[model samples]
Structure formats: C-alpha cells, structure tokens
Target: MKKSIIIAAIINCMAISSFAQEFGKHFADSTLRLDYIFGGKVSSDGKPECQVLLDGLVRTTGWSGRRNNLVSMPLAGNGRVTVRDKESGDTIYVTTFSTLFQEWLAMPESREVARSFENSFLVPMPRRLVTIDVELYDSNRKKVVEMSHNVNPSDILIVDRSNVNPNPHRYIHRSTHPERAIDVAILSEGYSVAEMDSFYKAAEIAVDAILSHEPFRSRADEFNFVAVGAPSSDSGVSVPRLGAWKSTAAGSNFSTFYSDRYLTTRNVKRVHDCLINVPYEHIIILANTTEYGGGGIYNFYTLTTAGHASFRPVVVHEFGHSFGGLA
Candidate 1:
C-alpha cells in the first residue's frame, strides 16, 4: 500500500509539472477574448438548424483561469471552445459551457423566428498562432453546428481593451493568488453611486452565504470574492411587463422570453468588458431590486435580486449553478 501511494504521488506531481510547462510554452500572461454570435432557426426540412459565428477577438490584461486543466474538462457542457496549435494540430486549451441561446432554441420563439445571442469567452492568450473551434450541442448531446477560424497572436486587428478603465470594485473575501483560486465578481446592476455601500454590504452577506455551504465551506480558502460598484443613473432593473424600465449598469431586465421570473441580460459582451480590471472566472450580478427573480447559465453568469427577502438563499442557489455547475 505504501509503495502504491508513493507511486501515485510521484505521478501526480509529474503531471502537474508537465501542465505548468505546457502552459508556459504555449500561453502568455494575458487573456484572449473570443466573441461569438449563437443563432438558430428551423430549416427547409423542418429540422432545427443552429450556427456559431466569430464576432470578434479581444485582447485584455491578465489571465485568471485554470492553468493546470489545460485540456481536461470536469463537465461536458452544452457547448465547447477548443484552442489548438496551428502547426502541430494539438489541443492546447479547451473549455465548456451552457448558453442562453441553447435554452432559447428550446422555446417556441426560436421556431417562429430566427434569432441570435451574444456570447464571449476568455482564454489565456496564446504565444503563437492557433486555430479555434466553437461548437454547440442539442438536447441529445449531439453537435448541431461548429465554426472554425485561425488566430494570429500578432494580429493587429484584435481589439486591445487592456487599457480600458474597470468598474470600481472591492474584495469581500480575499483568498489565495488569483492563479490558484476561484475568483467571483459580484457586480452591482441597478445601484446608484449613492447606493454602492449598500451593495457592498449585500456582497459581504453573499460571500458568507456561499461559504456556509459544503464543498465551499470546506474549501473556502480556494475562493475570492470582489464587489464591483457599477452605479446606475436610476436604481432598480427594468420590468417590461409593468412598463417599468430604468437605466441599469448592464441593461438587465425581468420577463426574459416573456417569462416573468426569468431575469437575464443579452449584453454578454458588455459584462466581459466590465471585468477587464478585475480577476474573475465566474460572475454574479446583484441587481438592487426587491423582485424575487434570478438566473444562472453555466460558464456564463449569475444574476439575482439583492434586496429581496430571499436574497441570501437565492444568491447561494444561483452561485451553485454558476460556480458549482449544478443543474
């Protein structure tokens, strides 16, 4: 037993070392943002046809994602992003996700009209040229559509957003270095500049609520929480059913897809743009509303009401979907 245990330990250490070397050889310490448009419609044969298109590529400062899991995935999500070495055709990096577009396609609206949704993903900036493949899957876990393209690290056309000013933010819970921890950014959606302090307090409560649960409770030190104070001209989110609209930070709204309780934002690119100044792999937007509604999409984001009576539990539950990858 001791010999076997020793061998396992040695192998694990070697694998870690190998991944670290691979990361250094292939990637820089920056982030490469892949912007995509996911769209779908019914085909001539009455079959659902889905497609993915590369909207843009952005370069930003710092990479806070996992460097060890360079090619392995913990979850086989609804969609995938694969980055490969153009020269050797070897997969250097990969990530998976679930999208709002995938959910919208299941609804009746997709059949009635073709529509598209914005999605953006961040990968460690590559040091050399690479080919990227974006894919979407259906309910049966079959690939519906895929788009491929090459990216040159030295491309002059890639948008350089590294110098953009980030929203005001503060750390609610400080953990290990960003490279070794899960960084969660809690963004203020509808809070005005005067209400930022209240948002900070709510973010603190959110941190405590999340860490109070198991897995997170036992591994609390592996997480870091930052409260982003993105103020609004008017407080509270939009309620289209009541004709109540306000100028919120991320343009979040209730009644998504005509479902009153489904709260979400279509401005995914804007969300990523806001986090350029912070270290975030997962996002949790705290809208300053008393409405009892929230939404979460895997590898996307978590948005919930901060002033509702069930704030604590709702934030925890939504974080499970965003961070824990819970169904």
Candidate 2:
C-alpha cells in the first residue's frame, strides 16, 4: 500500500512539472489583449448574419488568470477564443465568453441596420508567433462566424501598456497570489473625483455582500477585491429618457435598447482600458446613482447603481450573472 501511494505521488509531481514546463515553453509572465469588432445584420432573406474583425493587439503586465486548464474550457460559452502555435499548429490555450453583441443580435434594431460593437479579451502573452481564432456559436452550438489572425510577440504595432495603471485604487480583500485567486475590480463609473471615498465604502459593502453568499463565503480567501477610482467629470450617469446626459468615465447610460432602467456601457474597450494597470479577471462598475437598475453580461461586466436602496442585493444578483454565469 505504501509503495503504491509513493508511486502515485511521484506521478502527480511529474504531471505538475510537465504542465509547468509546457506553460513556460510557450508563454511569458505578461498578458496579450485582443481587441475586436463584432457586428451583424439581417440578410435579404431575413436571416441574421454576423462577423468579427480584428481591431488591435495590446500587451500588458502580468497574467492573473489560470495556470492550469490551458487547453480547455469548463463551460462552452456562446463564443470561444483559441490560441495555437503558428509553427506547430497546436492549440496551446482556449477560453470561452459571451458578449453584448450576441445579445443585441436578437433585437429588432439588428434587422433594420448593420451595427458593430467593440470587445476586448486577455490571454497569457506568447513568446513566439501564434494564431488566434475567435468563433461565435448559435444556441445549438453550431458555429455562426469566426475570425482568425496571427500575432507576433515582436510586433511593433502592439500597444505596450506595461506601466502601472495610474488610477487610484484600494484593496477591499486580498489573496496571497493573483493566479491562485479570482480577482475582481470594482470601478467607479459616474462618481466624481470628490466622491471616491463613498465609492470605496460602497465597494466594501459589495465585498461583504458577495462573501455572504454560500460558495464564496466558504472560499472567501480565494478571492481578491480591488476598487478602482476612475472618477467622472459629472456626478451621475446619463438618463437618455430624461434627456439628462453626463460625461461619465465609462460612457454608461440608462435606457439601453430603449428599455428604461436597463443600464449598460457600450464602451467595452474603455472599460478594459481602466484595468490595464490593475489585476482583474472580473469587473463590476458601480454607477453613482440612486436609480434602481443594473446590467450584467456573462464574462463581461456587472454594472449596478451604488446608491439604490436595493444596492446590496442588486449587486449580488448582477454578479451571479457576470461571475456566476447565471441566467
């Protein structure tokens, strides 16, 4: 029995060593950001067709995502991003996500006009050339459209934002290491520079709310929460229905798709730009408003009004959509 146990331990160690070596062989201790335009329109036959285009590649410091599961996804989300070695044609990494564009395609507006939405995703930086394929899937798991591109690590055009993000930030909770924990960044959306203290307090409340839940409560130490203070010039978010527009940090607004209280931000790239200096795997934007509304997209972001009477539960519910991938 002892001999068998010793042999099993040896095998596990060997597997760990192999995984590390394989990861180090292809990736660096950095991040590669892929920016894309996802668009679609109704065809003459009334069938909706969509396509994705490469916008740009960005390089940032640190890879705060998973070290294991480099070649697989736990959930087959609405879309997939696959990274493969250029020379070997071997898939080295894979991830799945859902986007606002996918949700917009179901709207009547898409049939009347062609529209595009900006999206951004992060992968571990590759040391060599790699081919990346971004694919969208239908409800039946059939491929809808795909865009493929090659990325070179030495490309001069890749924007380098390796410098520390200059925005003011505070850690509500922390983990010993980034890769071992789920990092969540709460960004101040409509709050002005003077209201950052309030934002921090709200972020702390959000952390407490999240930790009060079951699985998260048990695994609380495996989470890190940071509040990024990206102040707005205006003190509140826009309400198009009221003709009240504010120049907020994220360009977020209520009445998304003409639905009052449905708040969202189409400036996805800017949402990511705020976190270039912060380590985050998930995002939560706190709009400084007393309005009672919020929005969430799977693997994208959770945006909720911070001053609402139901702020605590609303934030928790939206997080279930963004982080928990709940319906």
Candidate 3:
C-alpha cells in the first residue's frame, strides 16, 4: 500500500475572508447563512429561514427532510440544513446553527495555516485508510451531522518542496537587471536538447487541453514553461513523493521539481544549486515517458500530474505555477 495522498480540491471562493472557528474555522467575504445540505453523499434539503443575523447571506427560509450533516439555523432559528441520499435525494437529519455564535476572524499572523485557502492535508506516503466527511449545526443546537459528501485530496492539492523558506531580506538582493539576463538553468539530470524537444512536444499537447476554459484566454500572459532533461535521484531527500499521479492549475508555483535537489531542506546552502537558483520564477518539467506518478509544491518545487497523458501539459502546468506571480 502506498501513502494515501490527501489532496483538497479546495476551490476557495474568490471574495472569501478569514474566519475563526473550532479546529477549522471557515469565513467568507460575505456571511453565509445557508447550510450546505448533504443528501446521502449526493443531495440534501434546505430551509431558508430569514435568519436575521444572516440576512444578506442566507438565501431562503423553509423546512427540510432527513439528513445527517445539517446546518441548524439563525443561532437559534428553527431551520435545518441536511444532507440527502446520493441517489434518491432523500433528506436524513436536518441540521442548523448553534446558539453559540462564535465568530473567529483571521488575523494577519495566521495566514500560513488559514483554512480559507484550500490545503493539501499531507497524509504522507503509504496512505492510511482514508474516510473524509463534512459537518455543521445550528447556533442553538449542540450536535453536528456527518456530511455524506466525500472529497479526494489528489483532486486539489499539489506537493513539490515547500520546505525551506527564503529569508525576508532576500527580496532586497534582487538581480541587477532580472529579465534580460535572468539565470536560465535547466534541471534535466538526463536529457539532451533533442530529447527535450520531444518532451516539449508532449507538453504542448497536454497543456492545450487545459487552456480551453475561458479564463486561460486572458490570463495566458500569466504563464511560463520549462523542460528538464535528466531528472535527479534526490526526490527522497528533498521533498515528499506521490504514490499516484496528481494535478493542479496553471498559476501554481510547482516548478522546482525539475531542478536538482542537492541540499533542499538543509537551508539554502547554495540557493542556485537548490530550487531558488533560477532567475525565472516559473518552471515546467516534462518527465520523459509514461511514468507512474508525480508531485508538486509551492515556492520551493514542482508537481507531477497526467503521466499517462502527453508531457506537454505537465510541463506547462508546472511553468504556470513557477511564474504565476506567486512570489
């Protein structure tokens, strides 16, 4: 059994804000009075009670059916949010908000672990029995119902080498004229230009598939791509590995994987030798063949997805992360 990769396809709503809750406090830019009804892992019911406190947030008020994961209402309002049957759409036990209206705000300090942004809950290699669910209750109630919905980690999060954090002052040490003469180093431990050309051809095919969405048209300029030749063996030493393939969007900074990993975690002894060695922020790594898996990370590395698919997208996606204004 390989490590169970827990990826959170955490598509945080754009206008979200910091919220403080127990364990995982979620807050949106706007108050959400409505409870996400879960119906047997497929559908659920909603009773929009004009929960006054959540006026702008809650959509409507009404009664509901059976569901376990219910969002009790109005911190005392008589409304329930429940999950339904995956097939029948039958409600289980209705849920609502509890009377204890504990509102936790996100302070500037807790940005790193803020639950607002989707995170890859690293359940390292050799994954354990994984069973995930959601839950919430009314303000006046004291119980929570388990959501029927199941979320997959690989569907969202990526892992490269987000281990070493650069010094704050490093920003001051900028390259005299960054762009025209940026340090363009290729981290191909084993490929030649001709081989890389083939890899790029593979990458192009895959990347074109992802760009079909409308957003990619205007945001096209926000992307970059690179190719690596001989991949290194330091994967075990520098960062974590994936048991299976994974995927991520274009603007992610997962380019470091293609770079050589000499002393990744031991502090940027030689920033250049490590991932920080490059001038261009973004990077793309096209593994030569139909390998079994890949990984990605933020600021310090790269991610591997779509091994069975052509190499084009894998490289483009990595490049998207590396140069997508993440720095």
Candidate 4:
C-alpha cells in the first residue's frame, strides 16, 4: 500500500513538471491576438452551418493568462481556441470562452437571414510556427463547427500593438506584477473630452464595487484596473427608442434586438479598436447616460450607464457576466 501511494505521488510530480516544461518550450512572453469572423448560414438542404474566417493577427506584449494550465480547460464553453506546435502537432495551449455570436445564433433573425459577428481573442504567443484550431459547440456540448489555420510567428503582416496609445488614462487599482494580475480596462463610451474627469470618477466607483464583492474582495491584490479616456464626439449614448442619437467612442446604443431596455452594440470591432495599446483581459464600457439599461456578454464586454442612480450595483452585476463568464 505504501509503495503504491509513493508511486502515484511520483507520477503526479512528473506530470506537473512536464506541463511546466511544455509551456516554457512552446510559448513566449508575448501574446497573439487572433481576429476572426464567426457566422452562420443555411444551405439548400436546410442544414445550418457555422463558418469561420481569419480576419487578422496581432502581436502584443506581455501575455497575462495562466501558465500552469497550458493545454486543459477548467470549463467547457460555447467556443474553444487551441494552439499547437506546427512541427509536433501537439496542443500547447487551450482556453474556452463564450461569444456573443453564439447568443445571436438562437435568435429568430438568424434562421432567415445570414449574419456574421466579429470575434477577437488572445492566446500565448508561440515561440515557433503554430496551428490554431477554433471550435464551436452547441448547447448540448457537441462540437458543431471546427476550423484550423496555420500561423507563422515571423509573419510581417501581423499588426504590432505593443506601443501605448497617446490617450490619457489612470490606474484605479494596480497590482505589482501585471503578468499575475487580472487586468480590467474601463473605457469611456459617450463621455466627451471635457467630461473625462467624470469618467475617471465613475471608473473608480466601478473598481471599488468589483473589489468589494465576495470572491473578488478576498483576491483584491490579484487584480488591476485602468480607465481609458476614450473621448466621444457627444456627451451621451444613442437611444433610438427616444430618437436620440450621439456619436459615442465605442458606438454604444440602446434598443438592441428591438427591445428598448436591452442596450448593446454590434460594433465589436470598434470596441476592440479603442482598446489598442491597453493591457486588458477584460473590458467594461461606462456610458455617459442616465438611462436604466445596460448589457453584458461572457468574455466579450460589459456596459453600464454611469449616470444612473443604480449605476454602482448595475456595474457590478454586469461585470459578473463579463469577468465571471456568468450567464
């Protein structure tokens, strides 16, 4: 019995050592951003199929993901991204995330009309050439669509976003080490340049609300916060139900999906574009409006109205959807 227990312990240690070695061998200290279009269309035979197309690649500095779970996922999500060494064809990294595209798939509009959504996600940059496999799953956890693309680390076409943006920002809460921090970027949506100070104040309230929560409260030191002063042309967001429109930084708008209270934006590319040069694993958009509407998507983005009376609690609840990946 004693010999069996000792042998099991040795095997576990060997497995952990091998896992760490794989992460160091195949990945670098940088990050690779993979942009893709996730869409769906019905065929002549009445079968719906989801298609994936490579949009672009971005090279960014300082990967902020877990190094221990190199090839395993803690949860099974609607979508998965897997990176493998090209030569060995061995998976070096894997992660699961939910997408807004998956939510749109169930809408009635998708049945009759073909639609595509912009999706951009990141993985640890490979030291050498790698093959990226993207998989989409159904509600039953069955794989529905799969696509593989090869990536060369030395590709010149890859956009480099390591340089910081000229826009002014302030840290609400900062961890000593970024690589070990859950970095959240708070972006201004409808606040103009003159109202940036107000945006910063709202951002602080958001950081405090998140850190005051149960699990996050205990792990406050493991998180970092930054407020990006993305000025808008107007001072408030667009509310089509009231025939009010404003040119926001992230183009956020209310009346999403024809519901007056469902605030969301399909301009995902613009939202990400505004995040250039920001080191963030999560995003929160603060709209300069007093409306009682907001939206959140798992692993995508969270948005809340900063001028609302319940802004503090709403922001925290929306963040639970974005950061915690809660439904």
Candidate 5:
C-alpha cells in the first residue's frame, strides 16, 4: 500500500509540472482576490439550486500557492474557480474549495426558505484580460450553478490592499520564500489594546500546538506564521445565550445557527480588512474567552476560543478543517 501511494504521488507531480509550463505564458506573479455572494433557493421542481454574484475584486502582493499546479486541481471540491485566456479560451489557472454556504443548504432551515452567504476566493493574476468562471456543485458532484466575468489587469476599479491598515504584527516563523511556503496569519479578535501581551502569549501557544502536530512538525521549514495584534474595545466575545455582548474586534459571537457552543462571526469582510497589510494564504482568529466553543470554514477562516482548558486540541482540530481542508 505504501508503494502504491508513493507511485500515485509521483504521477501527480509529473502532471502538475506539465501544466505549470503554461503559467508564465498566461499569468503574472501577483494575486487577485474575488469576493462573491453565494445564494440558493428551491426551484420549481422542488430541488435546490445555487447562484453566484460578483462582490468586488482586490489585488494583493505575492501569490503564496504552488506554481506547479497552476491549471490542475488535485481535489474536486464543492466549488471551483477557473481563469482562462480571453482570446483562445484556454484554461490557465484552476482551484477547488468548499464553503459554509453549501453546508447550510443541507440543514433544515434551507428547506423552508431561500438564503445567501458571503464567499471569497483567490487566484493568480493574469497578465492580460481573462475570463473568470465560478462553479458550484451539488452533493452528487453535479454542477448546479456557474457564472463568468471578465477582468482586465490594468483596470482602475480593482482595490489594492497591499499596503492598507499596516497594523503591528509579529512573525513566529519566517520561511525563506513566501512563493514556495504556506503562509498563515493569526488575528486577535477580542483582546483589548491593554491586553496585547496576553494575545501574544495565546498566539504563541496556538503556534506551538500546530507545529507539534504530525505533518507540520516534519515540514516546519515550509511554513510561515504571523500574529496580527488587532486590538479591541473589550476583552471577551459575545455570549448571546446569556444576553452578554461585548464590543470585540472581529464582531464574534456565540449561539451561531442557534447552537450555544458554536461560535462564529458573519463579518468576514472586516476580518480580511484587518489583515489587508499582511501577506497570508490562510487565517486563524483567536477569541479571548474561556468558553469551549469555536468554528472553522474550509478555505475561509478558523475561529477558536483561547482561554479554554481544551484550547490546544480544539484549535488544532479546527485548523484541520480551515487549513488542512478536511471535513
């Protein structure tokens, strides 16, 4: 079995290399983030269908993904985004991701009414104008929705977030090159300005727990870590069940989806805005609460309570969903 697994990995590497040869011919070295609203409703046939709407584009510096797998995706997730050359319509870059919106569709609430959720994704910037196609798939791996739009690299409307916010951040681990490493940013959610020291201490504990894990421990040198000290007005997140609400940095709250232990935040755009000045491919938010609750969304963000007794294990498990992309 080990030999078979090794052979399969080798074949995948060769295929990625073959596809990467076309990267330079079509795309540049920067990154472009496409934000969208993913909505769904029951059709006339009584089956659910999804739709995608454009939410603004932002250009950021340094793409931290693998250059070899520019056009081929190793995982066929619930959603995919593809970039193609405008003239020839040849696919130049492709990536797959899962979303919380898809999961909500399966819940009992979705069956009673229509709903929408905010979603975002990143792609390698093309050198010239290109067509971006976003696709959503159902549980049976069938394509249910698709939308396409054109993007010009020199367009003035694209927001540039390379130097915004410029908040103070510390690097726990620094890789030699970002382009070849996995970049992760840890953001402070509920710690006040005076409690930054505590936030830093919690960030250290989180980093240690992640690095002590299996694959990460063996490949420590291939990752970079940054702690963004985003201060808040208060020191604890909101517990809606207790009618206790505090002004946190990222607007996090408990009682998500009507579950008291399921902590989450709907302000995704604000979370990204806080890290505008930092370079990251993944994000983890540390909330300053001793409650045993947290949430994670694949390819989106991870939120975990830092002051709980089971903090280490729970945070690591949530990271598996947000960063490792495991279900």
Candidate 6:
C-alpha cells in the first residue's frame, strides 16, 4: 500500500483533457463512464455517480437552475470544470489549473510541476452511458452539448468513454459476485516452507476473514494468484536508502523494498506484456522467508518469504488489490 510515494502525496480530484469534446477518446471504447457523486445534491439510491456531480454543477453554476447561458463558476471545493451544449446535451472536456495552482494550493512546499496545454487531455464525451442530461449553451444561449453524469465524491473505478480528455482518469467496476486469481512465487531466504507454517496459516486466516466482507462482492472476478522463489540470502534482507522507503529494525528495511517494488509495480502493466507467463491485470508474489515483512498494491502484489505455507494466504489477500482494486 505504501508503494508509490508520489501518488500517496498528491491531492485527489478528477478532470479530463480539454474543454470541447465527447468522452470516447480517453479509454478503451468498450468501457462505460461513472462520475464522482457529490454528496447532498444527489442520492446514492443506486444512481450513477456522474449524474450527481453534473447535477450539482447545474444547480450551483450561477445558472439558477437554467440550462442556457450556464456561466462557468469554479465551485468552492471544485477540482474539475465541465461544459455542456444546451441543445445536444454533450460535455466538452476536462483540464487542470496551471501548475501554479497546484503549487499555490501547497504554498511553501508543492511537488507538482506546472503543466502546459500540450500535456493536457482534451476530447469529446462518448456515444452511450447514463444520462442526467444537463446541456450547456453558447454565448447566444444555443444548446451545444449535454453531460449524463456529474457524480458524488465516493471514489469508484469504471471506464468512462463519455469524456475522452485523458490525464489518467479513475474508474470503478462494481460486480455482484467477486472473482480473483493469485500467483504466489515462494522463495526461501534462509528458511524452508515447513518452518513458516504458523505464519502461513496466520496469513490465510487473515485473508479469509478479510474477504468475508460484502463490499467486494460486486467486483472480484479480476483476482489472480502466482508464486516464485526467495533464497536464504534474502530472508531478512532490508533495503536502506535505495529508494523512498526506509528499512526498520522491525521490518523497516522491508519498507524500502516496497518503495522499490512500487517503482517496478507502478509499471506492472508493462511487466505482463514483457513476461508471457504473467497476467496483465494482477499478480501475487509470495516469498517463503521467516522474518515478518510484506505488502500489497492496487494493481500489483507482493509478500515476504515465510514458512512452507506461511505466505499462501498473504498472496491471496494482496491479490485483492492487483486483481480487485478494492484497496
């Protein structure tokens, strides 16, 4: 979870590439769009999130509930801006405030660089999806486009072709039944599989208990599992100063390993492409070591070497992220 130090620090919000287009160009066309549902303005009564967010815009944009002449009003907590055609009910696109805005928000210390227009994602919304249908008009109050979803804030993962403006948008894929795959690579740093049985059982029980919850019921099919080897030399090894993570006496070095793992894990999408043996979406690495240390990521997975079976459960639990994106 403490994988990418940079991603962990950034402020969370959503917006697309540009101001004038449909949402089809951002991701694979086979996907659908789901927006963040802003609370209060919309209800979660099984309603799509995009509607809640867009509906809020119509209500607040100084339009006074009027669809035409929809003036652009940057909401107090607004992170993204949207524009729609009054007649056609289409959304133009999404963009970010200059890098200065990110810095100004952080003040004395901000890590974001000022991005230029060229680096922005600007495109059109897609052909089909949920339709809250709030259209925007031009200066003449002519209906230009309309948007189907303006959502509430609860984050979910789903493909959105509604806005092709891509700057790395997030999506939530909810499923009524959960499915997952796990690959555990068992390596022995200094111990054997038999010695780590206790830890293995502990990990398995923990994973089983964790999956007992209901939230993941809808989206678990993407799960996967795999395993590899960990030689004795790596049993209690700790990575110190090599990356953003630090080593601790009580598994501190393991933290550094995670940062480095993240450096690679972050690019896991490519890993699958390179290794014909690997799956593109998710994977679980189980090291058969004794010392305590392991971690899991949203799209990647890992576990330290435990006993003969100590890491089996660890691999399953961590796979939740690489396969389910639940974390």
lDDT string for model 2 (1-327, tens) is 343343233223212312356678889989999999999886777566998999989999988766666887545678999999999999998878888888887778888899999999889999999999999987678888998999999999999999866588989999664456777899999888889999999999999998897556766667789999998999999999889999988899999988898899999989888888788878999999998899988778999999999999999889877775566
Instruction: Give one digit per residue, the lDDT tens place, for model 3 in 1-327.
Output: 111110001111111123223112211111112222221111123321111111111211111111111222112222233433334444322323211111111122222222222111111111112233334343344333433333222322322222333211112122233322212222332123345444444445544643443344333333333332332332211122333222211222222323322111111112222322122322333343244334323322343433355344544444333322121
Q: Assess each prediction's global lDDT (C-alpha) against the native.
A: 0.84, 0.84, 0.27, 0.80, 0.80, 0.29
TM-score of model 5 vs. true structure: 0.89
Give the alpha carbon lDDT tens digit for every residue of 53-143 in model 4: 9999988777666666577754567889999889988888887778877877766676788888888887888889999999998778888
Tens-digit lDDT string for candidate 5 (23-63): 67777877788989988876656577778999999888766
The local lDDT score (0 to 100) that residue 105 gets in candidate 5 is 77
What TM-score, over all chains together, does every model reach? Answer: 0.92, 0.92, 0.27, 0.88, 0.89, 0.28
lDDT of 4 at 322: 67
In lDDT terms, how accurate is model 6? 0.29
Error of 5 at 282 (Å): 1.0
TM-score of 4: 0.88
Model 6 residue runs over 4 Å out of place are 1-253, 257-275, 303-327
lDDT of predicted model 5: 0.80
lDDT of 3: 0.27
lDDT of 1 by residue, 1-327 (tens): 343343233223212323377889999988999999988786656567988888999998888777787887666688899999999999999988999898888777877899989999989999999999998887788888899999998999999988888889999998754447667899999999999899999999889998886656655666788999888899899989999998878889999999998899999987887777688888999989998899988789999999999999999888767654567
Those runs of model 4 whose alpha carbons end farther than 4 Å from true positions after fitting are 1-22, 42-47, 164-166
Model 3, runs deviating above 4 Å: 1-194, 206-210, 226-278, 305-307, 310-327
- CA RMSD, predictions in order: 5.0, 6.2, 20.5, 6.5, 3.6, 17.5
